[model samples]
Target chain A: MRPKTLFDKIWETHIVHEEAGKPTLLYIDLHLVHEVTSPQAFEGLREAKRKIRRTDKTFATMDHNVPTIDRNNIKDPISAQQIETLEKNCKEFGIELFDLASPYQGIVHVIGPEQGLTKPGSTIVCGDSHTSTHGAFGALAFGIGTSEVEHVMSTQCLWQNKPKTFEVQVNGKRPKGVTAKDIILSIIGEIGTAGATGYVIEYTGETIRNLSMEQRMTICNMSIEGGARAGMISPDEITLNYLRDKPRIKTLNNLDSLMDDWIKLASDEGALFDETLKLDATKIAPQVSWGTSPGMVTGINNKVPNPKNFEDPVKRKSIEDALAYMGLQADTSIEDIKIDTVFIGSCTNGRIEDLIAASKIIKGNKVSSKVKAIVVPGSQVVKYQAEKLGIDKIFKDAGFEWRESGCSMCLAMNPDKLSPGERAASTSNRNFEGRQGKGGRTHLVSPTMAAAAAINGRFTDVRSFDVDLGEY
Target chain B: MEKFQTVISRPAPLDSSNVDTDQIIPKQFLKRIERTGFGQFLFFDWRFNDDGSINEKFILNEKRFEDSEILLSQENFGCGSSREHAPWALRDYGFKVIISTSFADILFNNCFKNCILPIVITEEKLDYLFKSTLEFEDYQVKVDLENLILSDNKNFTEKLDIDPYRRKCLLEGLDDIALTLIHEDKITLYEKASIE
Candidate 1:
């Protein structure tokens, strides 16, 4: 037998049929849904009079439009109606829903791993670009359009041209205060926004193996930002440790046999990939995005890049436009750029460990008078765990508004948004123009960096801060 | 979905690279359940001012490009979130085809689902098209999907390539779900075998 990559192993196992002159028909093991993207898909099913093929495999949640501040009072009529529509669809189709009243309700991507639905060697699809987040467990997961979502709901299958495999090998130990968010952002900066257009990336090397599952998820969550539909890390003991205590895993039989299978899912030695790129993790610094695109980023101590540094006319134009939208001047120190808001929540960095890291920096300091900072956890489970650890109290004592969870201020579909012309230091994935709000400027940073910025009202380096995030 | 074979119309040139989906259709309009009526809000933030007035500096606001059925952009078009609403907005706004140097992976797949032909061209050819369209207000191009040819009246003709399966579905307006349901037996067998 030929040596096989992890992606090839998973892709080959999921194949149901491969007809000549057509795309392969692959079976999906999980289908995650949310309020914003599933409404139209259910409507498609209703119009066709088709029943959901596998209700047991589907999961639904309310996010994107739910209010993070006032959890019950949904003032926007359109958003309320959208939520009601999802409730109606889930009820009619007999699909499990994590409603607003349920303790499990949260961002679909966050809750999936929390409940152990995302597993090794399984194929996952959601009507969200961030579905790549589940690939952290070594799954072949990717995002889909509503049409494909409906197709999967009807037939439990998808037709796709197999994507080639790419390897991103990161070696060496990262410095203290640099985080998974910084590593992923630096990768995006090195490989522009369109770097891995037609390939699935498998992150490998000593650096990846040394990180926790939460850190691996943070890296996979933003894989879409680098233009890949999916990214994965080979399953190992870290993956097993994260899944052992999950509720779904606790219900399964023959745990040891399942573990053996998962361990075998790693790529074989001497397996070939279509392309390979290497990075030294030790060289990475705490990154901050300064422009509309994720690729327009620089280290914390550096200044905003000059558009003249780029010789391509089109590249220069993009940089100039991004600078104008961000209300920034060329060669200005990143730490000198003032911010009015600080947002520390998203599927990217909204887990309990992320909250703990941020709380460590904000324990004794107050948020700047000029900055309004909020910390919304990723899920109800994460929220409960943080409160149990007294992390929420630390944030509240430091003048931060500790709130509920639901992708708040990330895409700004809900009430938590930056006002027009407001500048925010955010922990979300994308920094595209108007992503936070119309005419709003967003600079993407990690949780610790966001907390430090909230304290100083500017882009401050977490490395220089006088706190120790011991053993995190 | 609509059947598309060929289109002869003016092309609206979005000269920017990495034109993300959030800008194509902002999140504010995504709350609506129905898919139609999105053309009115296409590029809402860029087309309209904060005070609800028209911004004449935007390219789509120009009178000559009012009825464009084709969109021409630089590399990495539709680079952000996987909202199929981006293609719906472009389709609703009378764009049947998009030409670019490259496209984001999810958005590229979503275009085929929405009956839009996404064509990839070389940098040199795209530069020619951008220059010609910017120079002439009434410039038009002919996109023949059946023969995989893109041509203008003057001095440019290039052969394009598309996946045969996607091209066939668009040319015939076939329903993807209905087509896949034909393999129900195989799917069921695979499910049963895996369970055992």
Candidate 2:
């Protein structure tokens, strides 16, 4: 029994009704679908003899399975079929689709914010779990399954029980070497993966407020790492400023009027939470996942976790397995781990601001000869804006492959895959074994970290390789 | 379109922990815009051979669990990724109850809406449940929607704790759309009032 937080307020506003033990039905404001998770939902509709109820609420894009460099080459038949089926499904269902050739095509999480489809105090769902990326806008968003996808498509509402509220306040400003990604990674490591289960996290405190939209996005994007349904930052002057002048966003409410309502998005001073955690960001350092799960994280400067330190046999065995799979010594420093691939994209860090940070790290520097690097803009609009600023040229000049945006190398559905046992430093969420490719090991890091890894051909700190930013 | 009750023989054993949505329904299959024919591709990579033949090594291919309609799994089953296809594939491939010691937050939430039951049982009970599967005969589990109970001829009976609201929706087969239509009268009145 907690006082109403922003999550409760937003969820209650959309509540149609509730059943006692059954789930309450919630009206979904936006439904984002990508090629990888939509086909089945569309197929379910066909089987049920129904069509998409609201075409406007639903949007489709191809990202997970589309290749980055081989735009013209159709090397993999399975990848081609998946993309083709998505096209067929979208066309037949009359849903808007952003195919590969279309400039609107990008990561679904990235595209929603750029298009203003993501609004303050809205519920968003996609087939991709990192849809938590939308929570940066102070929206309640999470990944849904195909059946729920069909449910959203047909009715624009979903069955859900309101989750308990949890507030994570990070006091003090972040240290220079620490990014939002590092802070979240440290938090996940502290809480473990299932710590925030059945909770909607409201992040606050001066540290969270000081973060840029890109940095807030990076923090909120990985809420799933600690198993949150969604993570939200209260819509403040920062949120209002970010939404100003967006196209369709202005159609609903202009920025001036919207700010008046948006400021009320914070949790009340006396609001209660099922749980509360206060983090001091000043002490956090750059972190990396030593094991398969993102929660198996540690300071970049620290040695690998020893099995002797673990109390749970399951977790210890998992660490042992992970260490064996990752081919690392228990006491070896994380900085010593070399990377074969460095990907800076996906919903987590694929934004204009992410590119700006990465470019500063790789402005005149070159990627290591042994490392294959890719920079994917989160959205088509982000791509265009970055191109206008010649961010694309800076990356290309630094020898990173400039590719059309998609969930490239985040999950190995696309041609951008790692060979078996290949190690990667990725900006996307998730670091499970074989996540990037079958038998491919991924190390989750921020985009700047990915750039640093690319330059050194090993896990390194971006701050160490920083070139001067022109100005504020 | 059909209304019938199915009495499942028993739950099958899947020892693998942290079974992800990617493993259940891969990203490759997600490209299809439609939802049908997913059953065939369910567990495609795990249960099928490279040549599209059945991989006898897979648990789903075992004859002992061939008729099983329920799955009993380890902690954090369905851990990674939020592909709805995982449940669609599970339901389409004829699974109803996914009894696990624990489940991922996102996956468990998706299960109820997809008409799949995600039951959380005690670890001690899970140990007993896994042993109970050793004897295939008379291990039958009866799930009666009318009674809202999960029981067997044996002394084992577990009452499901579905939210009463969800119970109504599930028992009545009312999805979100049906629930929304219940407020039609109020909506109409509000619309009329707005115009006036």
Candidate 3:
């Protein structure tokens, strides 16, 4: 038998049909939907008079436009209407929905993993790009458009070209302050934003194996930022451990047999990859983006890049434009950049471990008067866990607004947004121009980095902060 | 979806790389359920001032590019987010084709589904197109989907590549939903066998 990459094995298994020169019709095991993207998909189904073929496999949630603050009372008529439409559509289509009050309600990416719906070797599709987040569980997950979403809803299949596979191997022990967020941001910086275009990345080597499930999810969530179709870590004992206590896993009748199958989901030894890149994990610092794109990143100790240093005219112009939009000076120290707000949550870094890491820095400390900081947990379950450990109190005591779970200030679809021209140290992925809000400047950072920034009102090295991780 | 055979129209030059989905249609405008109205809100933050007046500094607001039907952008156009609204806005705003050095995977797929021909050209060609479109007033390029060619009618011409299945689907105005319906019986059979 030919040696196969993990992605190749999963891709071959899900294929329903294929011809010599046509895209394969791949079977989807899970279809996750959200309010913003699913409305049009449902409308397409309604227009066609088609029914959801497998409603049991589909899950719906109202996340993007839902208000993180004032959870029960949604004021904006447009947002309210979108949410209402989703609820109504899910009911009509007989698809299960995790509504605002539901315990499972959270960001579509966050809640899918929390409920154990994302499993090893499964194919997951959602309308949102962050659907790649589920690839952490060894699933061949990727984002699809609303039209494709409708196709999956009606046919339970997608016509997809098999993406080439790339391997990102990271070795050596990570430095204490450096995290999964830092590691991914570093990789993106090393390989420009479009480096992994037309490929799915299989993260391997010592560093990936050592990461906890939450940390792995954080890395996989940002794969899109690097232009990969998806990023996955092969399932192992660590993945099984994460799934064991999940609600969906507990209800399974054949857990022992399922575990055995999942353990075999790794790529075969000597499997071929189209391309390979190696990174020394110990060299990664607490990273931060100095420009609008995730690729325009530097370590916390580094200075903003001078566009003049770029040899390519196009690259130089992009850097100049990014600097102008971010209101950053070329060659200035990144630590000197002042921030008015600090956002400490998103699917990228909103899990309970992320909160615990942030709280470790924020405990017994106060946020700078000039900085407005907020902490949003990834899901209701994460929020409950944080609160149980008094992590929420730690943030509240440090003057950070501990809000309900949602994609708050991540893309700023909800009321939680930075005002125009406000500079923020954000833990979310993507620092695209005005992504957080119209004319809002976002500097992407890890949770610990964001916490340190909140305390200092500027980008600060988390390693230098007088905090003990053991206490948390 | 509309059937797309060929288009000959003036091209607008957006000389920026990594023009993400949020920038195409900011998250604020994504609340609308209907796809048709997004044209007005396309590049809302960039097109208009905070006071609701036109920002003439923006290239799309320029007089020469007013009625352009083709968009010539730099690498990685429509990079972030998987919003089909990005294409909806572009199509609504009267762009029949988008030519770029590269496109994010999902955006490239979404463009075909929405009948917007996304042409992946070489960097040299993209640079030539960007330069020509800026230098000449009312510069038009002809994109022939059936022939798989992009020509300026004068000197520059390039052969483009597209998946045969996608090309067939677009020429016939067929979407994935329509294509999938052809094998509804197979899908049903597979689903039933797995369940049992």
Candidate 4:
């Protein structure tokens, strides 16, 4: 049977061959690189005396170790070294790079989409898990390992097996104050983090269909957290409209014609799925991860689940472990959890819209003196846009450290780390144990709710602050 | 290094939902890329105490699963980042079978390449497997790859669902790189032709 869903079509097109006892070899359309993961891969290339086969097909950027403060004074030698290493590697490999001084330089994920390098019906890979973010544009994008990165560097091909396809149909319009983050967190809560495992989650239905490009990106970006290879929505007029007239590649134009092939990517109404999950957008609310892992989320008003309430012994034990690690009582309200830091940016939540939404909540209020909040833009471009609208000044005026663009406290790659035992309310994805730092707790919230957490020093509903979130 | 028929073992039923990759192999242990030694650190964040003692409540610390080589996790196993360390750690720890309702895509593909058998069962079947293990004294599942069949001698039995070619690869213990090399002569001919 011919494939109906975009995932199947992309998979079929990319499949070099299918043989007994072997995975498929996919021809990678684009290869994205960064500092932390590329050093070893580039080192391997140097050792093997191989040049990047096709530099035009590959692109590079630096983000992981970029400092969030005093951008000009990147005094730390290691930080400087990482950026330098990326530049040197890209130059040696004959690949295009967007370094600090380059107007195109930004978060690797953010750069591809912003420049239209990422597009529908293509296969993309990066050495970062959040590479799944590109799937938002109706591409099959996912992260690969260093060895795999080296393999792709040497040969623009990946040894990948096709993933089973799953459909997550989110029906109904979102209620007020609910956001894309809430829709995803609610899905995580329903399916659990590993729910979409071994599948390319093709997000469908009216709700996902209606989301802005940025929101669709956010939704697909978190597909990793749900254990999907990548999450995607079929490109439509919204996608074409978003890509039109952007400062993208010179060759790319007229997305209207492109839509002909793009529209064929969605699953047919009666297409078979390995698994199907349905969600009601209207029922979701502002979500927060009270415990470790994105699946530990609940509505803003919900209480921490008691382990004893779990039916199964294994689940009970797991919940107990989370409770012990978080140092929270089972029945305590999530609203009561105190926080010391508030971070509102990452590839998952660091777009200009996220900043604008966050600024709306904190425009008039002051963050708690005890809370040290920082708003790091996903890219330098996002920073420029936010600054153009005075969003950065508003954030700084409300006591947020409006710092430089890059993945900061989200993983604490640079010096921007939370001390031990510090609790933070963040807009970035992932709340794994010590993900922020050793013994540092993280509660995932939407950017607006993160702003609320900054003001209140605990998790709170964004509605309490009374800013119209505009769209759910 | 090692070749085998499809890896066949019983998933040591851990009936918890949303088993994250971080919980499978935490970020603390991700500092290194040497994939071999991660077995010791598998579930380090979830299985150990802050003081480095085993958290007795964790499944790994349970006596019932001391010799368990297969992991039957609940839905959404290996969610989070596409950390290849997860399957490496699971394989290094000697887990051959990871039967679950679902798994994260990247890690799922990574598993087959590393000789880990990732099987997806229906949720009802998963519930059956989880509960059946509790009742049987041996509760052992035997996967015979040659037959492409899995059965617990006492009650439960099912065929492991996989793509036909993937099934062949698992049975033959071949990976994508190995598969590509199979057509090297043809590729060489094509390359020479293109050059000409």
Question: What are the C-alpha RMSDs, in order, of all predicted structures?
Answer: 0.9, 3.5, 1.3, 4.9
Query: Is candidate 1 or 4 superior in DockQ?
Result: 1
Q: Could you say which candidate leads in lDDT?
A: 1
Model 4, span B1-196: residue lDDT tens: 2444544344577766667666687554554524468899988866788789999988666777777777888766776666677887898988888888777666676676677778888988887878877666567788766677878767667876676765666667654544455555554453345335
- lDDT per residue for candidate 3 within A280-394, as digits (tens), equals 9988889999999999999999999999999999899999999999988899999999999999989999999899999888989999999999998888989999999999889
Clashing pairs in 3: none
Clashing pairs in 1: none
Can you give the lDDT of residue B43 in candidate 4?
82
lDDT of 1 by residue, A214-258 (tens): 999999999899999799999999999999999998689988899
Candidate 1: residue A177 lDDT (0-100): 91
DockQ (model 1, Cα): 0.89
lDDT of 1 by residue, B1-196 (tens): 7798699988888899999999999999999898778888889999999899999999999988889998999999999988889998999999999999999999999999988999999999999988898887667899998998899977789987788888899999999998898899999999999988
Candidate 3 vs 4: which has more DockQ? 3
RMSD of 3: 1.3
Candidate 2 lDDT, tens digit per residue, A239-305? 8777775666777734666667778876777888889999998888778787888888887788888
Off by over 4 Å in 4: A1-3, A19-22, A43-51, A70-85, A253-256, A263-275, B1-19, B23-77, B86-103, B112-178, B181-196
Candidate number with greatest DockQ:
1
TM-score of each: 0.99, 0.89, 0.98, 0.82
The per-residue C-alpha lDDT of model 2 at residue A180 equals 85
In model 2, chain B matches the true chain B with a TM-score of: 0.84
lDDT of 3 at A247: 88
Off by over 4 Å in 2: A1-3, A18-22, A43-53, A70-101, A250-254, A466-472, B1-10, B32-67, B92-94, B113-115, B132-156, B165-176, B184-196
| Best-first order by lDDT | 1, 3, 4, 2
